[model samples]
Target: MNRIAAPELDIRASADEAAPPLERPMRITILQGAFLPVPALMGGAVEKVWHEMGRQFAAAGHTVTHVSRSHPSLPAEEVVDGVRYLRVPGSDTPRSLAWLKVLDLFYTLRARKALPAADILVTNTFWAPLLLAGARHLGALVVSVQRMPKGQMRWYRKAACWHTVSSAVRDAILAEVPGTEEKIRVIPNPLPESQGSGDDGRLGAKEKVLLYAGRLHPEKGIELFLDALRVEAVRSVLVREGWRIEIVGPWSAAEGGGGESWMDRLRKHAEGLSVTFTGPVHDPALLRDYYQRAAIFVYPSLARTGETFGVAPLEAMAQGAVPVVSDLECFRDFIRDGVNGRIVRVEGESGVADLAEVLQKLMVDADERTRLAQAALAVRTSHAPERVAAMFLKDFALLSTLAVKVSH
Candidate 1:
C-alpha cells in the first residue's frame, strides 16, 4: 500500500519571543488500571488506544499524562513519542479480583497527586471512573471512555461526558443509564497505519496463512474456531490448499488458566492440524508484520461479556488483510459483507461451517481477496491517528464551549 503523510496542523505560539513564555497546554490525563509496553500487561487493544490517544493529544499541543499500574520492567516515568507515562506500583495480592481493586485504589491516589492539574481527565476503564469523578470535583472536566459492563453505568453518568470506540458500546452505556444519549459519542478504534511494504510477494511465496490475533478463550470463540476447523471437509480443503493457521495472543487467567494446560487441550483437539501458537506477540511493530504477511484475518467471536470493541480486525484491515468476523453488533457498524470484509452468522452449533465457507471462497479467489483487501485498507484510513485526534479535539472544543455557557 502507498503510504500517505499525515497532514500537519498549525499551532499558534504564546505572546512572547524573548522569554518564550510557556503556553498553557491543555493538561489531559488518562487513567487506566493496567498499562505497560510489554504484552503481559499492556498488549490489549484498550492499551493501544490509550497510547495512540496520548500521542495524538500531545501532538495537538496538549500535555497528556497516561497513568497506569507499574510493571517492574518499565520505568516509573517515561516519555514515548512525546506522551508522558506514569506507572504506579500495584498490589501484591494473589487473587485477581482483590488485586485489581487494590491496584485501582493505589493508582487512583497516586494519579491524583502525580498528574499535573489538567483541563480534562479521561478515564479509560470503569474502575477508574471514581477517580475521574474526584478529578471533576477538583474542577477538571471528566470524560469517561466506557469499555466495560453496564453495571458501571452509575459511575458513567457521573462523568462530565462519555465516549466509546463503537456504537454498540455507546448503546450499551445509554441502555444502562437513561438520558445519557447526548453525552455519549462514538469514535471508531484508531489503528496505526501498517508500516510495511505492501508487497504481496512476501505472502505469495508462503503457504496461505489465516491469522487469528487476539486472546484465546471461550468468549473469543477460539474453541468454536477450532471446532469448525475440525470438520472433515473444512480440514481437508484447508490442508489441500496448504493454508496454515496461526493464533497469536496472550493466555488470560481471566479465560481460565494461563499456562500450557489450556493450550494442551486445544492441541489435543487440533491433532494433525498445521496450527502454530505464537503465544503473545507484544510489540505492535511485530504484530503489524504478522498482519502484513497473513492472507486473511479471522475473528470468530461469539460472546460479548468481555468483548467491547473489535480492534484486532481494524488493525488487520489497516494492513490490507481481509477480516472474517462473527455477526456481532460492534463488527456490523464497519464491516459491510462482501464489501470490506465478510461476516459469518453464528447460529446453532455450526461454529466454523459458515466461516469455513467464507474462508474457503476467499482463499481460492484471488480477485475477491485483492478487492476486499483494498477496501479494508481504505476503511482503516478514517481511523488513523490524526483523523481520530481531530475527532477528539472537536469533541473537546464542543464540551469546553458548553462548559463556558453553563458557567455563565
Candidate 2:
C-alpha cells in the first residue's frame, strides 16, 4: 500500500501558528452499513457517532461527507450543518445478522463509487477493506472502527488504522488479528454537549419517572426491564404513586426490527402495567426533553453480541438521570458501581433479584439518587465532542507519516 499525502484544506484563520503544516484541515469521510439512517432520520449508535464525528470534523474547518444508505423521506443529496450526506439506494433492514452481512457485503462494493475522495475514511461497515483498492486510489487512509465484536477481520488487513470504542472491543479484534496491535487505538465515543434547555431531572424530585431509550431488540434487555418493573417491590411503589415507565425507541421491519411482533409480545407481557411505548423519537429537542424529564434511566442489555460501549446510558447520565445498567465488561469505562451510576446484575435468578432490588432502592432513596446524578453529569465533560474530536484530528495529522512507515 503505497502512501500519498492527503491534500490540505484552507482551514487557516492564518497559517499553522500552533499546528504543524501537515495538521491543516484534511477531507474526512465516514461510512456506515447500508440504510442506517443518519440521526436526522432514525439511527442507532453507529449512525449517531458518524453524524457527530462528521459535524465535529466539519466544524473544525475540514470538509466532511457522510456516505450512508438513503431513506424515502430524506433527499439523495443534502448538506446539514457543514457535513454533506450522500445517501445511496439500499435496503431498510434484514431478517438476521447473516442476511445483514450479505447486504453489507453488496453495499461495500457499491460504496467505493459513492465514497468521496478524502484524506481519511473512518467506517463501521464490516467489509470496508473490500474497498481498500478503491480507497487507495483516493489516497484515503482507511481507519476500521470496531463497531461490534463479530465483524469479519480478514478485511481489516487492508485498513491503515483501527479505532476501538472500548478496550474490550480492541481485545476482541486483537484476539482475531494479533499482529495488528501496533495499528489499534481505543477512542471512546464522543458525546455531544447538552443543549442546555431542559430540566436537570435530578433525583430527590417529588415525582419519579423511569425511562429507557434505544433499540427495542431482545438482546438490549427490554424484556428484563419490563420483568423487573413487575417485581413486587418495584411494582408496589409505581402503583402506589402515579410513577410510570416510558420506553422510547424505533422498532420497524424497515429498521431491522420484525415489525410489531416483539413489541406486541412485550406489551402483552406487561399487561395492566403503566408502561408507555413511544416508538422512535427522532426529534433531538423532544428526545432531550424525555431524558431531562426522566428521574431514572435503566438499560438492562443482556445480549452476548459483543456489547461494546452503550451510548444510551451515557446520554441518560448527561441529561442528569441516575443510570442503572447491566454489569457488562464495556460499561466499566464510565460506570463505577454505586459511584456515578448503579450497576445491576441481570444474568440469573439471583442476578434478576439484584436488579430488582437496585431499582427498588433507587426508587425509594432520594438523597442517594441525587448523589448519583451529580457524579453522572461528568459524562458530558469527560466524553465531550471537542476533546474526542481533537484526539482523532491529532491522529489524522500523523496518518501520512504512519502510512509511509507501514508501506515498507
Candidate 3:
C-alpha cells in the first residue's frame, strides 16, 4: 500500500509561551458511508461533521485518512481540502441491494487492509460499526462517532470512546446502551464561516418561497410539509399570496422504498401547487442562494429512524433564514423557541399548521424576521469551524488519555 503522509506540526498549549516539543502525530483513520466533496448527494449532517473533523485532525499533527463510497461519476481516489480521501465504488440505489451491501462490506474490509498504520480508528455511523470492530481487532484504539440511537449499541460498546454530535444524542445513546455513559462525549456540530453574499434585499418582489433542502423522503418530513400545504387555510394563503414551494434535493423512488414511481406520485400531487422541484443543488454557493431567497426554512422531520442531528437548519440559519422545524429531540438542543428559531410539536398534520403559522408570521412581519435573522447569524458565528476544531482537539486529547487507560 502506498503511504502519503503530510508534515506534522507542533501541538502547542494555550498558556505556554515556548513552543511545545514535537511529538509523533497520531495516525487516525475515519470510516464514513458517503463523502460528498460534491454537493448534490451529501444528505445528512454527518457528512459535514466528519469532513471537518478529518481536516482538523490532519492540521493538528495527525495523518487522517477518510474512506467512503465513491460516486459513479467521480474518481475512485482523490484528495480534497488537505485531507486524504479513498473512495470505494458502490451502488447509489435508494433501496438496499444485496450486491451493493456485499460491495460495501468488501470495500470496508479492503480499506482496513490498505490504510496506513493508524493509532486510532473512528467510525461515523452504525453501518460501519462492524468495520470499527475489525480495526479494534488490529490493535488500534477504536472511537465510535454515534449520530443516531439505533440498534448498534452492542457493537459500539466495544469502542474505546464514543463521541456524539449533541447532548440529546448522548442521552439517547445512554438510554439505549446503559452502563456506557462514561464512554460518551457531546460535541455539537461546527458551522463554517459564511463565504457567500446572502439575500439581495429584494424581499417582497421575490416569490414567497418555502425551502426544504435535504432528502425528499418521508423521514425528512417532506411528505408532512406537502400534506401541511394541502390544508385549506394553508393552500388558500399560499395561492392568495402567490407563494411558491421549492423542493431542492436528490429525489429518487428508491430513497423512500418507493422507486421512481414514488417521485412521480409526489410530483403529481404537487401539480396545481406553485411548487418547483429543482432535483439536487450540489454547489454550496448555489444552495446558499436558495437559502437566502427562502422566506422560511422548514425541516418537518417525521421518521424517528436515524433522525439524530440536523445540520441543515444551522446552515440555513447561517444564511439568515428563520428555521421552522419539527420538535425532534435533536432539533430541541440547538433550536430555542422564539429565540433563534421556532419549533412545532410533532403531531401529524397538526404540526404542519403550527409550522405554517410561524411561516405566515415571518412572511408578513419584517421586524420579527429581521430579529430572527440576526439571532440566526449570532448562532452561526458561535459555531465557527476554527472554534469547533479547537474543541474537538481538546476532547480528542482527553479521550486519547482515557482510551489508553481503558486499554491498559
TM-score winner among the candidates?
2
lDDT of 2 by residue, 16-38 (tens): 22223345678788877786777
Q: Candidate 3, which segments miss by more than 4 Å at Cα?
A: 1-24, 34-44, 97-103, 125-128, 131-147, 192-207, 253-258, 402-408
Top lDDT prediction, candidate number? 2
lDDT of 3: 0.65
Candidate lDDT values, in order: 0.68, 0.74, 0.65
Task: Kindly report which residue stretches of model 1 are placed more than 4 angstroms away from their true locations once superposed.
Answer: 1-24, 35-41, 91-99, 134-143, 146-148, 193-207, 252-259, 404-408
lDDT of 1 at 176: 82
- Least accurate stretch of 10 residues (summed lDDT) in model 2? 1-10
Query: TM-score of model 1 relative to the true fold?
Result: 0.85
Question: On a 0 to 100 scale, what is the lDDT of residue 369 in model 3?
Answer: 71
Task: Give the lDDT of residue 85 in candidate 2.
Answer: 89
lDDT, residue 6, candidate 2: 21
lDDT, model 3, position 321: 79
